[model samples]
Target: MTTDEDELYDADEDPYALALRSGRGPVYLRLVDGRRIRMPVHRWHEQPTVADKTVLERCIGPVLDVGCGPGRMCRALLSRGVFALGVDIAPRAVALTTAQGGLALRRSVFDRLPAERGWKTVLLIDGNIGIGGDPQGLLRRCGGLIAPTGCLVVEVELHDVEERYNARFENLQGQSGPFFPWARLGRRALNSIAADLALSVTDQWSSGDRCFATLAHQGSSFDCPDAGRR
Candidate 1:
């Protein structure tokens, strides 16, 4: 019943603290400085900002931040009084997340995820669908992370662009960067993935052309007038 993610996030030690000690938190790293690479040194959250006020206001109990590089999202979850834990594949990112007072662990999603069955939310923003370049798998993993009434919140843009290998995207700093191997899922993609995991889209919102959707294990509550729809 327990997974490797459970062991990696044990409460005793801060898994990502060592990375900060080495000071590589500023940007992604390149072992060879080119094509086929190891993995991205995910950008740590720089400043504190509420990306989603309504859903954040509703986060509960323990939270799991998947692909938690340097723990920015995990730290944000904690700010709401949720016992937050950050899970990542990079030792460096693991360090950063813990340095920020979060329970961080260096582990891949392919391994077990932190086992908090009743967690209120599992955050997958920042093109998290790119994990292994499979959106269905990502949502399937998130489904196991949510409590019965809990939600999985994700962000996407209304626009579409060339889908390529090791895709590039602008960071919070507005600097062009490699967000690699991402699968751009639009509204239709979102609905399909949700159903694949047997989850229902409950609420949605949009700003400008960007959109956010909240999926719950409960049936679709896409009744909100402001909820983004096709």
Candidate 2:
């Protein structure tokens, strides 16, 4: 559930906050093409922005928020009486979620999750698909987390390029995490990514600078996309 970073930061301290004071914690996605995109990490800690609310409005059923930091989206869903659960590896994030009257668990997406293949919607907002540095693997895992007809709403890069990179989480203090595989996919790349895993993109939308796509199994029936195989 909790990670080493939980021990590194105090109960009241958060990486985003620290980054704000020091001006450097924003996670950067360094592509192989010599292009690096700086993520708006601080936005995750603030109240749900208009763009985030627009994305939340698309949910139609029980939702699972992957890499839910501080649980802003979870809180918003709860206010709508929606059944939502936020999971993150950071203890403080889970605590913050529950503190705000939202359901949260300290866990990793790669680990066992509740109600596998049963959720109506699984969200990969805020560029969370980059978690664990394997976008394809994460998308495949999300394919199993949602119901056969369920939709996977993912927020992707707003560019027109697709790239994979080694990512690291760094703070204003210049502290950085270990290098991990990560990826950036724009609207043009969604179909290719989904088709690779036998999934398909059903819809694409944008709010402000944020872009999202809805994914589903290519077949009409419901079955774990990665079931019976690694």
Highest TM-score model number? 2
The window of 10 residues in a row where model 2 has the poorest summed lDDT is 221-230
Could you report the Cα RMSD, in angstroms, for every candidate shown?
9.0, 7.0
On the 0 to 100 scale, the lDDT of residue 8 in model 1 is 38
**Which residue runs of candidate 2 sit more than 4 Å off their true CA positions?**
1-36, 221-230
Tens-place lDDT per residue, model 2, 67-137, is 88778898888888888998887766776677678898988899999999989889998878777667888
- Where is model 1 more than 4 Å wrong at Cα? 1-43, 50-55, 160-181, 208-210, 218-230
lDDT of 2 at 105: 90
Q: What are the per-residue Cα lDDT tens digits for candidate 1 across 1-230?
A: 77444443433333222222222333322222343322233334454344544445545557777777666666766776668787777665675567668788778766766565566777776556556667787788777777766777776556543232454432233334334455567767788768777888876666544567878885633222222221
Score candidate 1 by TM-score against the native. Answer: 0.66
TM-score for each prediction? 0.66, 0.80
Best candidate, lDDT-wise?
Answer: 2
